[model samples]
Target: MPSQSAVGSIETKGFPGVLAAADAMVKAGRVTLVGYIRVGSARFNVNIRGSVSEVKTAMAAGIAAVEKTEGATLESWVIIPRPHENVDTILPIHYTPESEIYRQRVEGGGAPLQSLPGNS
Candidate 1:
């Protein structure tokens, strides 16, 4: 990850909203989807990281997605332009091994991973 990348998050009232947000976010910008968090009581959060401008763009798309979801609501969101390193160390926002594949592909000039066809 670049030292200057930004981190952003969208909190939604339901899993459907968060899922919508995550999909729109990555498609809207060259951002990496870190992961989702279950914040209890049916609430969830979608976290992402990318350039400051890209993060801002992704946040907009994500918020729109949440609003469009049938039974979901956007609760809150945030974008940290240059969060301190310690924040990455302690927060679940940091990329995991599973997500690293996408990051690596993006950095290596390859497209991010996509779903494979299901077996019959």
Candidate 2:
């Protein structure tokens, strides 16, 4: 799975549905979480790794499923590779931000706010 190692990373936004999708992948042995999935109200990101086909398939299906759930919005996604796939490096920095705007908006335990009409 070397060539497939870093086909790239996938991210999805949603809540329990997204969570359930991740759960299904794990249960089905399709992919594994390489790290923590950023949890928030406005958005969330889950990192997954596995065979290329399964990775992409699960991501698409999962995101779609989550988006269909109540209180969820599909954001952006990309197939960017993981850092240092073959270089064998050590993590020297934290990638997640605790003070990010998304986190702030999602704080206080209520659902995150959606953009106002005409705000784009």
Candidate 3:
């Protein structure tokens, strides 16, 4: 565990779901996060840093807790591992065709401007 703090983000759904997930971490140990979660939410980004084990534990617990909530969904890219270190990104970063809608909404990477929702 490095002596410095770490950062992580989880793009999830439901404000209550985010809150519930956060609460679980508090139960596990001391940590911190940001943003508000709610239903049909576009995203949920949280930053938590501590001992490596503690941070990993909190992250797993938080995501698990979020998943337990009804209507709470996690994008495949939701887990941003060691974002500070590009090499630490373990999850596949690509979005499948089935997930294009949600992926575009969250990433805003780019697509035909006219095809985007509300673009018309």
Candidate 4:
């Protein structure tokens, strides 16, 4: 079935900031870390999926974390509520097998779970 969840993305100037943002996002709210995009020039995007409210909360936390990282800058961000299915197939925002657990937890009405060490 097509997803009804919202998808959010936070672009950062460096990998470390994106990593921190992803960690903060899942910890701060019920969201799934779907994947990321390398936009070249050392820019990267950390993407997440959840309900609109959850995504918004996670995005805020992500931006804050990115801001706190040394030499890392927040480039941009977006949240698409109920994105079209075609977008999932056409874009790199879809969740992978490793991130499926987070999506399941969030959809099951549980708090977001943290990634285990060495899993990413």
Worst 10-residue lDDT window for candidate 1 reads 111-120
User: Which 10-residue window in model 3 sums to the lowest lDDT?
Assistant: 87-96
Off by over 4 Å in 2: 7-14, 24-29, 39-41, 81-120
Residue pairs whose backbone atoms clash in candidate 3: 14-37, 14-38, 14-39, 15-37, 15-38
Clashes of each: 0, 0, 5, 0
Per-residue CA lDDT of model 1 for 1-120, tens digit only, reads 587799999999989999999999989988889999899899999899888998999999999999999999899999999888899889998988877766665456644345412322
List clashing residue pairs in candidate 2: none
lDDT score at residue 35, model 4, on the 0-100 scale = 89
TM-score of each candidate? 0.88, 0.51, 0.51, 0.85
State each model's C-alpha RMSD to the native.
2.6, 13.3, 12.4, 3.2
Which scores higher on lDDT, 2 or 4? 4
Clashes of 3: 5
Point out the worst 10-residue segment of candidate 2 by lDDT: 91-100
Candidate 4: clashing residue pairs, number: 0
Clashing pairs in 1: none
Q: Give candidate 1 misplaced runs (Cα > 4 Å).
A: 108-120
Candidate 3 runs further than 4 Å off: 34-41, 76-120
